[model samples]
Target: MVLQGALGVSLTFNCGDTDVAQEAVERSFAIASERGDPLDRLRLLGPMQMLYFRTGRFGTALHYARELAAVAEELGDADAATLARTFKGVSFHLRGDLRSAREELEGALSGRPPKEVASYLGFEHFLAAIFLARTFWLMGDTDLALEQTADVVSSSEESGHPLSHVITLMWAVTVFLWQGDIEAAENHIDRLETRAAAHGLQAYLAVADGFRGEVAVRRGDAAGGAQRIRAALKELHAARYELLTTPLNVTLAEALCAIGHHAEALEEVRAAINLVETNGDLVYMPDLLRTRGRIEAAMGPRKRDTAEATIHEAVTLSRRQ
Candidate 1:
């Protein structure tokens, strides 16, 4: 019963029904707690952390990470402990503590918990690898980041799990995009779209659409790309999936700026900044600020001071990280 409830939460979350997902998680946790089974509680903790993380509630996610660790230790579950560490690493990354994030993620990945552990933890190691790759990129190890990303994507594809394939492919798309490999990005997006569709994973589909739109813009279809991105953003907002909002908004702003739509670009940038500020999503703050600076500069001399200030803030944050 508790396991079914946990699965229910995961399914609803993938379908973008956040409220139902949270309710299901709460019910599952309640059941697990009542049963007084440490393993059951540990299992429920993973989804609870994920639910909060997906909603940009990093602190709450971290709280669950702590609980997960405690329960995993009580049960002597090394696999669960590894998964809990991964969650903590990701939460740390989101909170802008890059060094600690690197340490935790490295520890999790180094141990290479068995495949059964990955299955039991719902393949969270894939997510950990993705976050680790991102951290590597942010820390100026782009080559290693790309290598790690490729490894994760390849492994995920070989795993033959639609959920894992879609999630890993989505991050792989981001890596390709950052590398300026538009063709590679599009290819991964295609795979992600197919897998997400097969699984009825609406949230991943929306994310793919957003990435596809970004690729289109980069490929020189600025107007068309901007329209597609706008549509995807609408879908994401409707679904209350704010996980990718900052990056998508940045992409949209870049597309608009490319098309000489500085005013609209500025608006998008501001919206992204507001989102991160309100959600406490510092993971993308530096990028958001950088985009804001670019838009402000494109708005002309009237906003030059604002542009400098915005860019300076980004630089300061980057250095601190």
Candidate 2:
């Protein structure tokens, strides 16, 4: 029962159902607390920490991760320990402590727990690879990012893991967009959208649209890209995953700026910054900061120096891993 509830929470969380995820987490925690099973506790801890992290509750997530690590040790479960360390690493990343994040993630990967079972081992590999890919992408090692993504893709296919494939597809899109490979990004988006629709994974569909919007904006198709982004944001909002609204807003801001709506673009960027600050999730704030800087640069010379400095900070922080 406890395991079921934990898995349910994770599923709902991934699908952008925050309220359902919260309820599931609460039930899982209650069950684990009553059962006094260390692994169960760790299981519940993982999604709970992820929820907190996604909502910009980094300090709370960090606290829970530490507690989870201690419990994993008591339970003598190396796998759970590694998972807890991954959360800690993510928390560090959110806090802009990239060096610590890299160190901890490296340690977790180095201490790779042997694959003991076939049923869920594929997920383990995919999760670890995705986490590493994200960290390396942030660190500006695009080659390593692609390599890690390739690992996830291969393992996901070999294991027939649909969810893992979806996640990897998103990661690949982000990397391609960052590398300025519009054609590759579009190809990946098309593939992801087709798969997502066939599987009824609306959240994945929304993410795909968001990525398409990003690529469109980069290609100077302001109207087309903004339309896609607006649709994506509407879907995510309906699903109650406001946690990532910043990215959508930034995408909109870019489109707006391209279309000569400078004042509106500035407003959108400000909203994104406000959302990031409120959520305390600095992991992607650099992107928002950079966007705002660009918007400001177009306004006048008075903002040019400030804009350049902001972009410099973004590049520096993003490469810190």
Best by lDDT: 1
- Show where candidate 1 strays beyond 4 Å: 13-16, 116-118
User: Stretches of candidate 2 above 4 Å error?
Assistant: 3-7, 10-17, 53-59, 111-114, 117-124, 242-244, 305-309, 312-321
Model 2 — TM-score against the truth?
0.86
Residue-wise lDDT of candidate 2 within 1-321, one digit each (tens)?
Answer: 566565655666457467667777778788888888877777678767756754556678889989988997898877777776677776776666767777777766674343552222234445556666767877777789878766766666566667667666766677677678899788878878887787777777887878888887888889999999999888877765554467678889988988888899999888877767776667778888888889888878988998899889778766652
How does candidate 2 score on lDDT?
0.73
Cα lDDT of model 1 by residue, 1-321, tens digit:
466576656665576467877877888888888888887777778778777766767677888888888887888888878988888898888878899999999988885444746455456878889989989988989999999998999988888777777778987888888889888898889899888888888988888889988988888998898899899989887877767777888889988998998998888888777767777668788988998898889889999999999999999999998
The lDDT per prediction is 0.83, 0.73
**What is candidate 1's TM-score against the reference?**
0.93
Worst 10 residues of 2 by lDDT: 113-122
After superposing all C-alphas onto the true structure, candidate 1 shows an RMSD in angstroms of 1.9
